[model samples]
Target: MTLQANAGQLLVHRVASEVAKDCFALATTFRGPGAYARGDQLVRAALSICSNIAEACGRGTIPEFRQFLRYARGSAHELRAQVRIAREYDPARALHCRTLESRTTLVIKLLTRLHDRPPPDR
Candidate 1:
């Protein structure tokens, strides 16, 4: 089956796809299988960003998509934060975290621009 690309939905899809790829890389690096398991949490948060965006867009409502974009942005931020936490635990992973952080920041910018509207005339 082929994925039909929708112009209105491109940004979210692109950002989400990139995020998913990075998350997969992150998951492989994560060694949090023991107590206080954070691996799953990180993966969930990362995936949630993309899933929420897709779900909202699928609903076919601008407002709904905006709201979901808010959550998606938050998820990106959460993943970035989690990456930092992991970096703290393992300094060597700083490079990986930095890369993910950069991509996540771009996602936030695109979402913010898409959702933010100009002020109405008085």
Candidate 2:
């Protein structure tokens, strides 16, 4: 498949993508069946941030987009908490959590900016 520049140009997209990648890496660190559920939750939350942003953009309305951005931001916050819990459960993954936290922060800040601003003219 081909990649496009338009979507990549958004700061939210870039940051969210990074967070998702980090989360995927962290998920693989999960050991045993008991830890699988927790890892799955972290993966879902990370992916939700990326999916919500894209879904928001697809809604074709500024208000809808802003609303979705808020959803994405909420997901980011959730991921942050999940990361902290993961760190507590497994200290070895603390570094991964730190990186994910930083990327998630960037996504939240960009989403806040998009939500507050008027839609750009087509």
Candidate 3:
């Protein structure tokens, strides 16, 4: 892969990883009454974003890569929604939720840009 592609891939991976970590941390803050289910959904959505991005990088064709980027973007949106819910569910963690939401937005923007741009030769 070209250096530029490699750099872009690394950036996405790093940001996705951060989102996953944040989600996992946020999930732990849930307490009492449907906490487990809500936390699990948040974690799953966050992991999906990372997984989709990784899958996109491994795909042989640009089309496949773009498709996966779309999936990742969708997952990021899902995570954003979850973050909002969590913020409302636990006002004590509002700051963390806002931070996570911002990061998720960043991931969405990054994935969208990657999906729209012409792919480097694979």
The CA lDDT of each predicted structure is 0.71, 0.80, 0.84
Query: Highest TM-score: which candidate?
Result: 3
For each candidate in turn, the TM-score is: 0.79, 0.87, 0.91
Candidate numbers, best TM-score first, in rank order: 3, 2, 1
Pairs of colliding residues, candidate 3: none
Q: Quickly count the clashes in candidate 1.
A: 0
Query: lDDT of candidate 1 vs native?
Result: 0.71
Cα lDDT for residue 86, candidate 1: 78
Counting clashing residue pairs in each candidate, in order, gives 0, 0, 0
117 Cα displacement, candidate 2 (Å): 1.7
Superposed model 3: Cα runs more than 4 Å off = 1-9
Candidate 1 per-residue lDDT, tens place, 1-122, comes to 22222434567568767777877777677665441356677788888887877765554556665677788888888988887887787678888878877888888787787567411222
Encode model 3's per-residue lDDT on 3-29: one tens digit a residue: 124423567779989889988888888
What lDDT score is found at residue 76 in candidate 3?
90
Query: What C-alpha lDDT, on a 0 to 100 scale, does residue 55 get in candidate 1?
Result: 64
Where does candidate 3 have its weakest 10-residue lDDT segment?
A: 1-10
Q: Write the per-residue lDDT of candidate 2 for residues 68-92, one digit (tens) a residue.
A: 8889989989998998888888888
Using lDDT, rank the candidates from best to worst. 3, 2, 1
Model 1 pairs whose backbones collide:
none
